[model samples]
Each structure stands twice: as C-alpha cells, then as structure tokens.
Target chain A: MNNHDRFVTDTAADIAAIARTEGWLVPPAPIGRIALRPWQQAVFWGLRIYIGIMLVIMGLGFFHVAGG
Target chain B: MSAETDILAPAEADRITYTEELEARLHDRLRIQRLRSAPRGLANRLALGLALIGPGLLVMLGDNDAGGVITYAQTGATYGFSLFIPLMIPLGFIAYLVQEMTIRLGAVTRRGHAEMIWKRYGAFWGAFSLIDLVVANILTLMTEFIGIRVASAIFHIPYLVTIPLAFAFIVGILVFLKYYTWERISLFVAAFNLVFVPLALFSHPDWGAIGRTFTGSGWALPGGLFSAGFLILVSANIGTTIAPWQLFFQQSCVVDKGLLPRDIAASRRDLMLGVIGMVAVAISIIVISGQYLHDLPNAASLGDHSVLAGIGSRLGHGAMVIFALGLLEAGMIASIVITASTAWAIGEALDVPRSVNISPRRSLYFYAPAILGTAIAAGVLMLPHVPVGFLNLTVQVIATVFMPAAMLFLLMLLNDRELLGEHVNSPIRNVLSVGVMVMLIVCNGLYGIATVFPHAL
Candidate 1:
C-alpha cells in the first residue's frame, strides 16, 4: 500500500483499539468543517485595527480635558 | 434455505453494529476530552459562573459613576423623591433592554462596537461614532475626576494632589491587571458605593414622608425653569444609567471573558441582576438626600461641587468621611472601566493587538489609550478655565444624540440571522428595542431644540 493509505489505516486502527479498551466505539471523521475565506479573516482583523487607533486618540484627549 | 438466509443476515448485522459502536465511541471520547479540559460538574460550573459575573457587575457599577450619585441625590433634594422613584421603574426596564442587547451582541459576535461599525458601516460612520465616543468618553472621564477632586476637597486635600494620585492609581491597576483580575479589584471598589445606602439611615429622614412621596404626592415642577431643568436632569440621570459606552464596554468584556453561545442565557441573567442592583443603589441615594435635606433652602445646591465641601459640617465627620470614600471609589473605578473600554474599542476597531491579557509592550495599543485617557483627564482638572460644567453637559448631550445610532447598530446585529441563528432577539425584545430607539430620538431632538432656543420648549 502507498504511504498515505498505510498512515490512515494505522491511525484508524489505533483509534479503534483505544476506543475498544476504553469501552467506547470509534466514530467516523466529520464530513464538514468551518473555514473562513481569506478576505473574511482580513475584514475581521481589520476592524480590530481601526478600533485600536481610536482608543489611542481618545486616551490622549484625556490630557487636554484634564487641563493639566 | 433457512440456514443460508441466517448467515447472510448475520453478516449485515455485524457490519451495522461495528459502525454504530464506533460512532458512539468517538462521541464518548470527545466528550471525555472536553470534560477533562474543563470540567462542568456543579462545583466547576459554579466557579465559572462566579468568574463570569465580575465584568457585568463592574460595568454596571461603573455606570453609577460619581456624577450619577450626585444627580440622584440632587433629584431627591429638589423633588422630594416621589416622581423619580416611579421613573426609575421604567428606567430600570430601559436599562435592562439596552444592556441585555449588549450582552447578546457581544457574546455572539465576539467583536466590540467600534469594530462592528468599521466593518459594517465603513470608515465615515465608524469615524463619526468613534469621534462622538472619544469626545464623550473624555468629557465623562473629566466628570469622574471632578467627583474625585470634589470629594478630596471635603478632606482638605488639594484637587491637584488628589487628581494625579487618582490617575496614577487607576493606570497602575489597569496596567498591572488582566481582565479577570481588573474586574475583581473593581468589584471590591464598587462595593464601597453601598456606603451611600447606609448613609440614608444616618440621615433619619421621615420614612412617612419618603413613602408618601413615592405613593401620593406628585413631583413638584411648578415653575418653568424647574420643569425644564428637571427634565434635563431626569434625562441626565437615566442617560447616565445606560450611556452608549456601556454598550461597547460590557459587550467587549463579554467576548473577552470567553463566553460561548451557550453562555448567553447566563450572561443575560448576570446583566439583569446588575441592572437591578444599579437602579436600587441609585434610588437609595436619592431617597436619602430627599428625606434628610429636602427642607434646606439650597437643597439642590448640594449638587454644586463648591458647596459639597460643607457635607462634612452638615452630615457629621464620620458620615462625610464614608460619603467621601464612596465618592472616591465610584469615580476611580469608573475612570478605570471607561478608560479600558476606550482602549478596547480602539484596539478592536483597528484590529490592533489589544487586551489586558497581553503584556504592556505587546499590548501598547490597549494600554496606550488608557494611559493617555488618564493623563489628559487629570490635565483637564488642572486647567484654570476648562468650563467643567459645560464639558459635563456636552458629554451628556453627545451621549443622548449618539444613543439612537448605537441602539440601531445593536438592533441590527442582534437580528442578524447569520450570526445569531436561533439565538436572535424575539418579537417582544424587538418591539421594546424599537420603542426605546424612538424615545431616544425624541429626547435628543427636544434637547437639541432646547439648546438652540433656551425659552421654547
């Protein structure tokens, strides 16, 4: 068998064996997983960056308001 | 024929059992692993509940800043506590509606207010909201320091001396502590605000008068100026109870607290309890001031920062000391929370590294705002001609104006099906939210007109 097939076989067998020993059954891998698009991740973090600059500006404004 | 059929069925049976048992085992293993990582027995869940509670409680108490206390006190002294008590009834519900939305939005989105605005509305609206928030936050922070300075003057300390020290202490606490630790420390400080409640007892005002005021006599707004000023102060009182910063702060804190979607119910319960505590304490302040000081000629003048110096002479040194401590604690804790919220919003909006969890060097964006906020607020206090009252009034007006926009964003996020799925706000919540937004718009409109034409409304 090829290396990829052999590795899958070994891993599945190990999981199955462990399950049996622990009084459990081995389940199949999930069919789907969540994956954000590159652009989405970029948008999410970009929003965070804008908020940071505002906070710095707001904080400095305190000195002017404090009137020291 | 029977034996052959039995053999075929047995083969199929074995295949089915193997698949079913394997699936069960995998599920069990995953469950075990999760439990091992974070156990959810009674003890563990209770501990988590306690830990999750700090931010909600601190944010609510922070809402009851020193200005809030004095406003409530002045309301009582001026109106004798009748109308204000019932007003708090609706006010509490309003507080709940507004605050609960924040908890939901925060726990679900895992993004702060500024961040959401930046993403959804673009930079123009984002910058507008940020500018309003920053201006309002700085102004509010000034009021807190003013409370500190006024309270210090009661004890014969210079405002300058007290202001710097208070700033240093607030910065040191926020800088050294993470979110969890900062919350815990702030809660301890918030507890001191209960001093006002007991001070109510020391006043020994007629319980009968106080009760009658609530149940029978209407609030006295006979004159024109009194009526106008009363509405303004009422707006201020309610406005102070659930300002826009609270929406940003509490929600950001929820996300930072690592609350999952499953924790939404718990977080709401936490927020409701906080709203109750906040309104109860504020009413108590008003009640005390009304009962004891209503007969005095300059009762409303008690809110005057300059005249507040006579508090000790009137209330006895012991009572004054406790009141002063309460004032100091309220202002300082508010300064910390507001500053932190200011930092969190900026960081969240800009996608910069922020949070008390990260070290100062790594979290410069987070800590920088907090440091700058305190410094400038302290500096404002030192200035000779800062027009502190106008600044305070401007902050309230700004909050009143921007409130509708904040509420609009909140309502939109809460109704987002993609984000909330089945957890979106129900019909009743939707109606209540819309009603609140409408009321806020009216309040702001009237306020604007009144500002422009002092005699009209």
Candidate 2:
C-alpha cells in the first residue's frame, strides 16, 4: 500500500484503541465539516467590528501624517 | 470483533482518511506507548518530563529573539536596570497567562489556533488573521536576518556567507527532521541564549546597588517616566515580550507536540521554567549593559551591534564573541519557529496536510510558505547598505498594530465553551485575560500615537 493509505489505516486503528481504552461507546472520527453555533457567530461579528474600528483609526493616522 | 478490526477493516483499506480527531488520537497512542515502555523510577519521570517540555520553553526563549535582546541592551544602556528589572516580573506573568491559555486550548481542542479560528469564526476573520500573521511574520523574519547580519559582522563574517548559511540551516532541519528531532535541536539552540547570564557575572555589576534599585527608588524614572523616549522603550519591551506570532506559534507547537489534557500540569511546569530562564537572560543583558556602557557618550544612540562592540572592548574580546554567538543563535532559532508557524497557519487555513510527520511530497503546500519566507528574508539582507534601522521600526509598528487583535482572538477562544468544554476560562482567567487585553490595547495605542506623531511624544 502507498504511504498515505497506510497512514490512514494506522491512524484509524490508533483512534479505535484510544476510544476503547477511554470507554467511549463510539470512536471519534475526523471532523469533516465545521458549523459554528449562533453565539459563536455573534462573537465573530463582534471581532469584525473591533478590527474595522482599528483599521479606521490606522487610516486616520495615515491622513494626519499626510496632511502635515 | 476487536476494536481495531471494527474501526480499521471496514474503513476503506486502500485509502487513508486524515482527520484532526484521528491525528490527535494517534498522538495520544504514541504518548501512551512511551509511558508503557519507560521503566518506573525517578529517572523515568525525569525523562518523561524532559520529553514534555518543548513547546513552552521554546516559545519563551523565542520571545527573547534578536530584536528582543537588542531592546533589553538598549534599556540598560539608556535607563539602567532600575525600572525594567522590576518590570520583567509582571511581563513574565503576562507571558505565562497568554501562553498557558494556548496550552489548554491545544490540548482540549487538538487543533492549532488558526484551524480553531477558521472553524469557529468563518472565512473572513480567518483570512484576515492569516494575512495579518503572515505579513507580521515575514516582516519580523527580516529583523531576525538583520540581527544575523549584525552579529556576523562583529566577527567579520560577510553577509553573503551568513545569509545563505542561515537559510540552509533553517530549511534543512524542517525539511529533513521529524518534530521530536527538530524540537530538541531548537531547544539546544535556545539554551545558548543564557550566555548573557554568565557574561553578566563577567561585568562585575554592583550587587548591593542592584538590590537597592529593586527596593529603594530604582522604580522611579531617571528622567520623567512619561518622556517620549522612555515610552518608546517601554513599548518596545512590551512588543518584544508579547507578540502576535507567539500566540500562533505556541498553540501550533503544542498541537504538533501532541500534548493531551493529562499533560497539562507538566506543560505548566515547563512553561514556568522557560519564563524564569527568559527573564534571567533579559535582566542579565540589562545589568551588563548598565555596568559598562551606562556612562558612555551616545550610549543611548548606539545600535545593538555597536553596543556589543563597546561592551566587548571593556569586558574583553571573549565576552563579545560569546555575545555574538548568542545573537546568532537567537536569530537562527526564532527564524526556525516563525517560519514554521507561518507554514502551519497557512496549511491549516487552506485545509491542506500540515504535520511535520508527512512526507515532503505530500506536505509540500504545508512546508512551502515557511521555506519561502526564510528565503525572502535572507535575500533581502544580502542587498548592499540595507536600511536596518527602518526595518526595526517597521517590525515594531507591525507588531503594535497586530498584537491587540491577536490577544482578542485568544481571549474569545479561551471563553468558548463549545471548544474548551470544562477547560473554558474560569472567572480569574477571564479577568486576567481581559486585564491583559486592555493593557495591551492601551500600550499599543500609546505606541501608535508616538509612531505617528514623534514630536508629540
């Protein structure tokens, strides 16, 4: 088998072993997709606003220097 | 059916599916295997502890990069150890708090900070953060190269030789070595940073006076504390200790090291040790510079290269050589880390293969950005009469603009219960994180104003 295929098989076995040891009924798998909750989206927007204000301040500083 | 048969046999035997959870479990297995085989004794515990200590120690030493060393030296020469020595204590705490969150996040989530941000915050913020981190990292890498040039020149080594040598050394390790080997080599380079501590002893600084400065009026500024120059130095020191790249670097490093939740206490001990070493080396530089160069004319104006030469003249040539070696190692070690961080962040953001364990052929996209950054920085330094001072100022400005944004993301991530579960920020942690975030914002604002309106400061 190729290296990538072998890596996958080995990783699957390893995860299975760990899940069994920890008494997890179902073994965890790789995250195929990520969808944030509503609260997370709100926090994300808050960050965007913070970054936007910072950019504006930076622009003003640029203009102040230019006008001088 | 056996667990392995149930999980692995039914999975497509011909193809390997690589996922974040699977990768984390594989690391868990590796740690478990090591523990099973190691003999039970004090020696075994020591070995295990040594094995677990890389990410935190590397991050702290990486903070004392070439630019950071120069800043400390300038602090000592201009103001002496009175103000900044005491200042290092608080800075160390800040460093620990900021970095410890990364450890918990990495262990609990099993994802790098970049991947976590992307998964939770969506593409706009993820892309924005990636761009900011990459730009800052490349610019910072240039300063490291400039540092390499200055230290090499002290020994009369040409730029043509030093730049390429640095590139080869940095790229060779990443491309060929696995994570464990790469980390150990990097740690050895980091230990050289303590060369300053012994050199401090060589300077024969007045211990009684140094002690008095700690308790007596040393906290008071020689000139007014709010002077433009003092504020600029303070900003630089803050910029050096806490940085945008450090958050990305440490979180990714812990993930790469495969640390699990059970390893958290050992990791904290590792982090505290690193902080102590970092502060010791920083204060040592300040003390040595204060003793020998404090009274010299133009001491404040002299760059790090000249300062080293001046200190060498007074203390003897051997001291200068050791200083140059330390500077070289600082630049080299930080270049390895910064470049790797850039690579890891880009790889995770793009959903590409991103571990050091993958073959070069499979992980080309993962490794390319880092190699490209190192190459570009090395090329820039080889140009004739490069404006080193302007590059330094640009690094500080980029850091001032980017650090608060980085800290905000870290604080938000720490509070996310979905990501951290029981490991989410506690009340005290929340207060400390917010307090640090506010302090960084205020400091960066002052630095921003000073940069724009130099005369106003």
Candidate 3:
C-alpha cells in the first residue's frame, strides 16, 4: 500500500482504540462527499432569507444617511 | 478478518478517524514522546510552558488590535480615567471565561469552531457564521491597516512604503513558518504591546486620582448612565474585547497547537496571563492619554493621531514615538491573527487542510483568504480620502451585530453532549455565559439605537 493510505489506516486504528478505552463510539463515516443533512439544509435556507432581509435594512440605512 | 479487510476497514471504520481528531491524537502522542525524551529539569518545564503559550497569548494580544487600542485612546481622551479604565478589569474576566471555553472545546472535539458548527448544526447556521466572520474579518483588517498608516504617517513614512512592507511582513510569517515557529514569532511581537505600560509610567499621571476613580463613583457618567455617547463607547469596548473572529481563531489555534486534554490547565494559565497583559496594556493607554488630553477642548472630537500628537506635546517626541510604535505593533500582530482566523475558518468549513503545519501547496485554501484579505485592506488604505471614520464605526457595528450569533453557536456547541461528551460547560459556566451574553446584547442594542439617532445623547 502507498504511504498515505497506510498512514491513514494506522491513525484510524489508533483513534478507534482510544475511543473504545474512553467508552465512546466512533461515528460512521459519511458516504461520498460531505453533504448537509436534511435539518441543516433547512437551517441554511432560513439563514439565507434572514441575511437577505438584513442586507435590505442595511442598504436602506446607507441611503438614508447619504440622503440626510 | 483478512489482511485486506483489516487494511481497508480502518479507513471505512468511523468518521472520527477520518476527521482531524486522528491527526490531533497523533500530534499529542508525538508531543508526549518529546516530553519523555527530554532531560527532566527547569529547561524541560520551560519547554512545556513555551509550547502551551501560543493560542491564548495570540488571542488576548490580538484582542488589543489597532481598533481596540484606538478605542481605548479615544475613551481616555473623551472621558479621562473614569469608568472605562476600571471597566477593562472585569472585561478581562469575561474574555477569559469565553476564551477558556474555546480551548476546552478545541481540545475535546479536536476541531475548529466553524467545523463543529457546520458538522453538528448544519449548513444554514454554518454559512451564517462564515459570512459574518469573513465580512467582519476583512473590515477589521481595514482598521488594522488604518492603524499602520496612521502610525507610519507619524514618523513621516508614506503609505507607499508602509502598505507593501506590512503586507509582505504579515504574509511572509504566515506562509513560511509552521505552527511552532509561527507562534513563537507571534509571541515575540505580542511582547511589544507592553510598550504602552512603560510609556504610561513616563507620563507620570496622578496615581492617587487614578486609584480614587477606581473605587469612587467615577463609574457614573456625567451625562447620566444611559447617555447615547456612553452606551456607544461601552459597545465599542465590548465589541473590541469579545469578537466573532476570536471565537473561531482561538479554537483553531488550540487545535493547531495540538493541545490535548491534559494540557488544558496550562492553556488556562496561558489565557489568564494573556487577559492580565491585555487589560494592563489597555489601561496604560487610557491612563497616558487621559492624563495628557483629558482637559483639551473637543478631546472627544480628536482622532487617534491627534491623541498621539497631544501626547507628544505633553511628554515630548520620544513618548509619542513610543505610543506610535505600540500602535504599529498592535496592528501588525492583530493583522496576522485576523488573517489566520479567516483562513482557518474557511478552510475548516470546506474540510480542507487548515493547520499551519501543512505545506503551502497543500494548504492553499488555508492561506488564501488571509493573504487576499491583507492585500485588499492594504490596497484600500492607498486610496485617497477613504472614509476611515465611517469605516471604523461600521466595523464595530458589524462586529456587535454578529457577536450574539457567534456566542450562541459557541454556547450551544459547548453544551452539546454528543460532541463535547464529559467536557460540556458546567452550571456556573452556563450562568456566567448567559450573563455575559445578556450584557453584550443590551450594549449592542443601545449602541445600535444611539448610532441611528445621534441626537439621542
């Protein structure tokens, strides 16, 4: 095996061993690339809408100050 | 199990192994090995202490950025050695409480603040945080460069010479050095922040009056407690101390430093020292400026440079040069930290190589945000008639606006039993955190209203 893969395997074993001693379960690895969970997606969209509103308010403040 | 199964299973075994936690554990083992190999003596103890000094010292000194120093100077010039001087003492405790939690979180999770939020909470809160952090970091970098420019101008150095030189210096340290070396150099720069303390001594302020102000009713505002000007300065002070970037920066720095659970005590000591040092320097600046410029007409109307000039007139050119040097060092150190915070947060969020230990080629995403932010901020300072006053005010406003959200995520993450396990914040910590959050929200709210209606004061 290549050095990088070997290193990864060895390190992973070490962490698992440590977690077992600590009585903690190692969580399962995510499949494929990292993607947001369903709940996270909802939060992302909610924040986006909030950010949009904040921007409008800020923009209005800018105009008001300049106009004044 | 077959050999192939053993080899491949480990990688597919668990998420924690694939994450930075594995690397953190390896790094911790290496550190312990070094400690074992070392000759047991004062030198060994010193070496261990030095190793634990980076993140906390960097965060606290970096907290006293150009904007903060400028704010303190303005505070002294405006109100003298009244409430604000003594106010910094308790603020230091608040800073320590918030930042110590970051160290614990970093040690326990072996992940940066941004990474924790993204993986645990989801993308919306993550993006919300990243956006606030990146925007605030850039604006704050502008304030740092403004400080550099102002200090340079005091020495008759032009922006043409200052901007590129400062940029190269910041980028060079970040790009060339690994975490260990980078931190030592940063601590060296951070030491110069104490120049203000000695300069304050040279100012020869009335110590008796300064002491009396601390204990007496000088905490009361002349224009009453809820005055608009008073509230705005209080918010600015809070904004300068407990910032959004600090949350990301300290956690990432702790992770990068490879601190383990055993090292948490050393980390706390380092943080306490940093807090003490930061407050001392801030009070020194306030005392010096407040002593000289307190009675000056329109002292509140004076800019940062004007305050320095006033110091020059009172204490001579030498004292002014010392003040300018302190300001320059504050900007340079904070610029390094602010840039690193941005790079670390973005890299962590994207799951890229984020530690300063990685090679430049491997860590391009880790370094790009910082270098770009520094370059753009330095470039902007070159423009003529930049609305610096407006920009500085806006930076504070942005910081205050985003701070509550950042603190909320931090508190939530600290309390997350799944992630922090046994290291979750205790009841007393939660009470203190809530108290700090409430004060921050009220101050920011009052400051916001005051900004919108200046005549309210």
DockQ of each: 0.04, 0.16, 0.12
Question: Model 2 over residues A1-68: C-alpha lDDT tens digits?
Answer: 22343245445455555544443334323333456567856755665565555546545543453444
Over B298-382, each residue of candidate 2 has an lDDT whose tens digit, in order, gives 4444565677787788888988888888888778888988888898898899888787656577778998988997788888888
lDDT assessment of candidate 3: 0.76
CAPRI docking class of candidate 3: incorrect
Q: What CAPRI-style quality would you assign to candidate 2?
A: incorrect
Model 3, range B163-191, lDDT digits (tens) per residue?
Answer: 78988988888887666667889999999
Quantify all predictions' global Cα lDDT against the true fold.
0.65, 0.74, 0.76
Candidate 2 C-alpha error for residue B165, in Å: 1.2
Candidate with better TM-score, 1 vs 3:
3
lDDT of 1 at A56: 47
Candidate 3 TM-score to native: 0.83
* Residue runs of model 3 more than 4 Å from their true location after superposition: A1-68, B1-33, B36-40, B453-457
**What tens digits encode model 1's per-residue C-alpha lDDT throughout B1-457?**
2112232343443343333213333333333233334756887666556655755777788888877766676667667766787677688788888888777776666667777767765665567667767767887888888789878877789887999998988888777755556667878887777777777766776777666666757556744433445545656676677787888888877766645466677777777777777877787777766665556564443543532544555677786777778788878888988888888888876778666555576667777876897788889887755454334433554565556656766776677677667778898999998898677655545544454455787
Candidate with the greatest TM-score versus the true structure: 2
**Sorted on TM-score, highest at the top, how do the candidates line up?**
2, 3, 1
For candidate 2, report its TM-score: 0.85
Q: How does model 2 score on DockQ?
A: 0.16
- Residue ranges of candidate 1 with Cα displaced over 4 Å: A1-68, B1-48, B224-226, B295-307, B384-394, B450-455
